[model samples]
Target chain A: MHASDDGPHGHHHEHDHSELSDTALRVRALESVLVEKGYVEPDALDAIIETYETRIGPRNGARVVAKAWADPAFRDGLRRDATAAIASLGFGGRQGEHMVAVENTPEEHNLVVCTLCSCYPWPVLGLPPVWYKSAAYRSRAVIDPRGVLADFGVTLPEGTRLRVWDSTAEIRYLVLPMRPAGTEGWSEEALADLVTRDSMIGTGLARAPGGVAA
Target chain B: MKPLNAMTAALEPVAPLPRCAEEPVFREPWEASAFAMTVALHQRGLFTWSEWAECLGEAIRAAQAEGDPDLGDTYYRHWLLALETMVARKGVAGAALLAQRQAAWDRAAHATPHGQPILLENDPLFTRGA
Candidate 1:
């Protein structure tokens, strides 16, 4: 985070007021204008930011994956209709209105990309990271899933078929990574901890129970 | 690791995705603000996702035409443009009003001292008349 006083203008001694980057100034200006014009409410803006910042994130999706792994019935439900299954667990809205849960198995791996743009399952995974939205990832994921995975340092077994799902405006995807070994009889909370965001996105695998940080 | 083809190799050094513990989803505070503003406007029924998508698509295309490279950094910049364009097209706020407000903010931000909030009232040209 840039400190209040440290910025592009930090070296200048002639000015009394701090300088902000043009982009930052523009955003602040736009918000002020919108608030003053009554097009938006200041409180509402804060509420929305607060929601994404805290209440909604990959943690919500981790719990869903954990429940699916621990309970057969929930796993079936997810396979049948992921949107409702995920919503039933209280994580659905906005970008996640339509959902598909693709499972990763020893025989096949599932990867996701949005070739047209960065359409992602925000309800499940939170906002996409920089790389997921990069042109390299979007264009190359479908054409070269194995290579993309390799870039992420994930190497699949020989002959493991890879399926790449291109996210669209109508549908979003969440990869249900296979449960790791040695987690037998573990509580859902502990299981959820093993569900990394990358695993759920199919860029990496679920952390081994023993590999989890202490 | 399998060797990448020429195309993938040209786009080498793909930045690693930030781990959940490594960084926040939003890199900058303004990016979050821009994202929240768009979602808030959508929730208010000012526009639909499809509409937002179209506007964003157009913005991205325009940026690309000007050699944007379509890398990830400018994604939110396009998003903000889309939001502004959508708001203007919908008549929620006119272009002139937005421009005026932008100028006001620029002034206010400059007038604010370090560590102080940049309030619209601080804009040197600000008056309650409008």
Candidate 2:
């Protein structure tokens, strides 16, 4: 596991008064203005904001992963239609929308990056983590995916076919890396240990490193 | 990664704007992802543009009666669900391969802390807002 600066359950500390910067406050204010103009309903807009900020996030994706690793049939369904497949796992929500999960193998590699704007699977994958939506990463991933992967310590062979997916549409693409080797007789929860966020983005592969899913 | 400080932070909320007149209750911001997805599929020749438009309109109406006026706001997910329902209803891509891929992504997300970050530059919300 990545080292937590605060340690496990480190969320108890309240050191930074500035942490509650309310960066979204300005956006909410603007939304209220639009609401007054009758462009959007106050309740609905509030729902959107609260859904993103509080109710949903990346942790949801983790749950889906844990479940899929446990069930064979459900895993098959997710591969067919990620959106509904995920819903079958009981993980769908408002923002997850239409889903397409792509796979990466030893012969072929797949990567997802949004070039135009950040269009992500919110319900299943939850809100996007930070780097997937960065300008530097977006431009560079398309132009030099190999180079960026190198930066991430993921080096692919020249023979490996690199498929870069620009997630610009309503249908979101999630990378499904080949199950790591040396994981026989492992439970789905243990198998889930091997899947990484980068693997889903097509940068890294799921490996059962150190008996932990790293 | 550590959360950004005020000076270096990248995600800041922008002021909201009024909805456009007759903006089609189906044209919610989240729905923009669905619109974009259909456009992508059309570009790839997965289906004709007219077919997508027709289907989207129909889905909007169906979801409306379901008491989901905000259905459009969550378009992409709806598109996924709709696509699943439609694909099953009509049989498009093979289900096994798709499920496998979805499982793979789930594993990947579980392994990586913070998973993938949705950069604002690539986010439809930011671009459409602009």
lDDT of 1 by residue, B18-104 (tens): 223355757788888899989988888888877777788788789888988777777899888888788779877767877777777
Q: For candidate 1, give the lDDT of residue A146.
A: 79
Tens-digit lDDT string for candidate 2 (A1-214): 2433575875644322111112122222223233334444545544555555566554556556655656667767778878887777666644356778776657899888876545666675555544554445556678878766655556776798998887744667777777766666777667666666667777666766575333
lDDT of each: 0.82, 0.53
Candidate 1 chain B: worst-modelled 10 consecutive residues by lDDT: B14-23
Q: What are the per-residue Cα lDDT tens digits for candidate 1 across A1-214? A: 1234546866635356756777887687678777767878888888888888888888988999999999999999999999999999989999999999999889999998887778889999988877787666787797778777877768898989999998887889999998998889999999999998889889988888777421
List, residue by residue over B1-130, the lDDT tens digit for candidate 2: 2232431332123211112222332333444333333333344455653455455445545665586533123444445455444443444433553444334333333443343432223222223333
lDDT measured at residue A44 in model 2 versus the true structure, 0 to 100 = 56
Off by over 4 Å in 1: A1-15, A212-214, B1-21
Best by DockQ: 1
Provide the TM-score of chain B versus the true chain B for each model in turn.
Answer: 0.81, 0.47
How does chain B of model 1 score on TM-score?
A: 0.81
